[model samples]
Target: MPSSRHLIGELESANLLGRGGAAFPVGRKWRAVAERASGRAVVLANGAEGEPLSLKDRTLMATRPHLVIDGALLAAEAVGAPDIIIYVGAKHRAAEAAIRGALAERSNQLRSRVRMMSAPDGYVAGEESAAVHFINAGDARPTTTPPRPFERGVDGRPTLVQNVESLAMAAQIARGIDANTGLVTVSGAVRKPGLQEIDLGWTFSDVAAAAGGLARPVQAVLLGGYFGAWAPVDEVWALPIAAPSLRARGFTLGCGVVHALSEDACGVDATARIMAYLASQSARQCGPCLFGLHAIGECVRRLAARSPQASDLDRLSRWSGQLAGRGACKHPDGAAGLLGSALSVFADDFAAHQQRRCLRRSTSHPASLQPVAAVA
Candidate 1:
């Protein structure tokens, strides 16, 4: 596609927001890079949505690679970048192929302008800073940031690093029209497990309906990815998917993967499994992360072993806040986010466990939602 300012205008008009789980404004991020004096800039499309329960990124790269690449190119043009990078998990071969195919079919100029880098598949590895570190010869782990990617990135140059869905939304915005919302991959206990693009401000019920409704009566909803919130189905019923609303509710419209569990699923056991996965995914660079995650995991294991004691619950609560902002990365914070929400929404469950009488006992669902390995 020819370079054009109209593309930027289109994004601004469409309100084509970023869908990178964070839901940051693409227009604002573009302006940040556009104002930089570094002269050299780059765009990185982060397709490593490491949420094991979510397939939105892989689906997008598999079926709509051109749109994402087009968005990346548009971002590059807006920021005056001559180069663009598509960072994907190594294991997503289908997505890699789709991106390759999309690039091959494009003009030689477009093809030559973009580079695809497959990152090691790990949860923390997909964070923008981590991806940047990996691209710059460091390990695929997040580095402490005062110089965030927008300020200094990709060999100390200004960069726009966004999720694959964010870039794809930008591409759609480049088409000069507003999309109602964006795509989401809703799995777990849903009648249909797939990706669907819906209008903004839709409720959880709307998303669930699009997915062909629940396979069984819903017990609770895990909105976002691994480190997201858990709410009773009732609380999530009219819940809007927009970041603002979700945040207001003490939740986030994260990676757009809502895992609705049935009444048969034990919340405590589920929490244990997820915590175990988070602990394992740590890059093991920071003390708080390495030890805190293990400690938290051990705590969950205790809870699962029998229900946590009232004292145990109190201890978990205290540690949740302690670890919230102490880590080098957001791993602890995200873990805290998920755990805190679990504590709040599943208060009864925690209490029941404390009494050694959980409402549900089934552990049929896997212990973890982490992909077997990082996708790279």
Candidate 2:
């Protein structure tokens, strides 16, 4: 039998929001699927977060798959969907096993209802619409919106897709956890770089402390992921991690990613590296995302290679805005957000570069921006 609708009713009253990068209200998404015509609907836990620097989704699935699956089950019941799909990244073997094991341990009623599928290893493949396409024998690139997942999804049925962390949060809400916190995997220069559950009202300082603080004096902090906010370390310490508050600061919660940059770290170089990675991850379906992200990455590369001209900076900012909302998915918007934040956070470096000076470390290669795991 389906879990009690009364339990789902309790979840609805908690005002839970998706902990995914998009942060949609979970109850609203439930309503969308629930009210669809009497045909079948589906629920997906997107554990395919392929961004190498961000590990929150994988961590959730690996360590707490039951929470994710229970949440998925609740979502499926709420929407009257007979099937549940837990989509995991190809490389997330640990996560895949956790989901399988958790399902195996469940009653036959639950075990028979859910299917775990692996997706191609690409960053954009985890996007909701893209996941629907991949599941339907189409390529893993995102399609044009308005025929969005909620309206027409997997096999032409309504689908409610959410990130693993978001589903886990829903489970917490279903269980009536008050002031439910979400997980952020803090990495990079922090002394501890692991998944930490923090209340929404907590400041960046609290997260940093949870991650064992910085390894050295910090120059800046990157919130979210590759497509995230770049703030002076001091300034970010004042900002809370909640979606609404962070959005008011023009930031996306971005799948619970928090990266700290050390004093010796070059924000300009780090930004360039991440941009290059994002460019490489493009599924190449839309012309704008395919061309625009590579172009942005190329510009960042040139700036890091030699002193960039003031014109170079202006050109980057201009292109950044042009690419903001022009793609089939949020890829362009993510790229623009990262670029804009880099421009704002690396102002001093941009100035120095424009004046014909380099600001990179003498002994280290630029790739040190790769994150490290947090110790307990």
Candidate 1's C-alpha runs over 4 A off are 1-6, 307-310, 366-376
The TM-score of candidate 2 is 0.92
* Residue lDDT tens for model 2, 58-159: 778888888898888878878878878899888878888888898888857582278999988888888888899899985787888989888788888888
Task: Write the residue-wise lDDT of candidate 1 on 1-376 in tens digits.
Answer: 3244556656666666677667677777887887892558888899877778777788888888888887788788787888798998887899999898888788576832788888887898888889999999858888887799888989888888888888877776566456667777777777777777887779989999998988877788888878788888998789887777888877776787777877787888888888889999988988988998898888877877774655787788888888887777888888888888788877887777777777775755642242322223
Write down the lDDT of every candidate, Cα atoms only: 0.79, 0.78
**Candidate 2 at residue 164, lDDT?**
81
Q: What is the C-alpha RMSD of each candidate to the true structure, in Å?
A: 2.6, 2.6
Error of 2 at 178 (Å): 2.4
TM-score of each: 0.92, 0.92
**Candidate 1 pairs with clashing backbones:** 89-376, 90-375, 90-376, 91-375, 91-376, 121-374, 121-375
